[model samples]
Target: MDIKNIRQEMALLDDVIPLEGHHYAACLQTYEAASSQRKLILEWFTNHVIPQIPRDSASFLSIGCGAGELDVKILAAAKEQASTIAYVGLEPDSKQCERFTASMALPSDQNIRVETLNTNFEKYTEQRRFDRVLMVHSLYYMNDPERAIEKALNLVNESGKLIILIASNDTLNELSSSFWQMENGGSTWFSEDLSKHLDKRGVAFDRHRIKAKLDITSCCAPESEQGIRIADFIAQAPTGELPPGLRTMIFSYLEATSHLDGEMRWLPHNVDAFII
Candidate 1:
């Protein structure tokens, strides 16, 4: 399979379908099964970001919080530090919202409140500000990421901050960037572009890079059902729906990008956190 041929095929594809809630959930499951990226993110957030937060009392506004996986851990840290915390999560998908809400059941003895809004940032009606506003890997899918950043920044209190967790252009992007370019008619935002935008706008922010790796051993196997799901996730499409030649190229691309470590394949999966 030719990588160059795959790029040409990806460019020929004009229409891109957004994944349904269930599809996204399945993809996430497949991704996490072979990746420790999110675990690293939680650790970094707890050590680096949480320490900078106010310990007395805090309010958290999590934008596009899906399944509340990392948010719950962050909330636990906040609850441990602060006397009270008012946490609100914004998620548009009902399925992920259900999962997010279910995991957010803190102990009754805790002086914390959790609320989930089944809406995006643009439709959120409350004028309430938060101590920390987070958009963890959600900016890419927002209707307008730049505007969303601006609005999220506005919703932060004077002494508070808006934190954005975005992925960097690692080997993961090497596998998916062509799909994104054809789908969006432009390149998606990576850490470099985000930093450049902030610098050009004279926006002051601190950046933290979390280096990590993804185990794509399953993704490298041709007969692994989980591998197909992960390939779908990487390409953001139904792999079964893809043309045979293109699908072969997709797997070939993955095997090419990943480095062999023992019997497993590892792919670079670094992420960046921007504090505004």
Candidate 2:
């Protein structure tokens, strides 16, 4: 099938498959995994990244910070260090942003000054640059990831860091291989490719790449279980119906994997830490 046909098929699947709750649950599970990863990321930042910074007070901008799992962890760390860190989270999804803000208001020792911006990173502009800018697991949704990276770079101050946590092309290719085979599609976006594209755009940057594996078997329990509650939200068209084959394929895939142990297993997620 042609690329256009593939896109149409995928769109059809998206329409018919009511996977919003599934995705929401999956995101929560992924966030829990990310919470674990956050510890390592924090350690890396504290031992290596933070010391490199020249200032005691740092401003951090996270594009698509999701439910603020990483933000909360980072803010808690800053509290321990007695550092003044300002955090700005940009999330396109209003619901998720609301959840993030609600979660941030919880009692904590972390003197985290958080501001949640309900807007896209590309459309949002800032008068001042940040000490660190990050896009964690959210760049793939962007239509123009290269431009998004440039926009992120523009938000960074001199000697500041641009941190990106993205699934490697290889990892995505592998995970989606079966789905692609079943549906006939190609690969998704990549962090390394984005980095290379950034370099081609005349952006001088460095990279610190790392990989991690997470176990998420507990999250995908039966739908009745409260392990990870995800809403299966499919975008409905005017017809409000999905193609038969597309819907079948998606649900079948979900069913096949629902009971399986979910793990990142060598799924190399590139954490490209760029210094400008």
lDDT of 2 by residue, 23-95 (tens): 5535455434533455666676676566654446878888988778667776665555546778788887787
Residue 257 lDDT (model 1)? 76
RMSD of 1: 1.7
lDDT (C-alpha, whole model) for all candidates: 0.83, 0.57
lDDT of 1 by residue, 133-204 (tens): 999988877666688888888899999999999988766875566676676676678888789989999999
Clashes of each: 0, 12
Question: What overall lDDT, based on C-alpha atoms, would model 1 receive against the true structure?
Answer: 0.83
| CA deviation > 4 Å runs, candidate 1 | 1-3
Off by over 4 Å in 2: 1-26, 34-36, 80-82, 106-112, 171-187, 216-276
Q: Which has the greatest lDDT?
A: 1
TM-score of each: 0.94, 0.67
Please give the RMSD of candidate 2 to the true structure.
Answer: 6.3
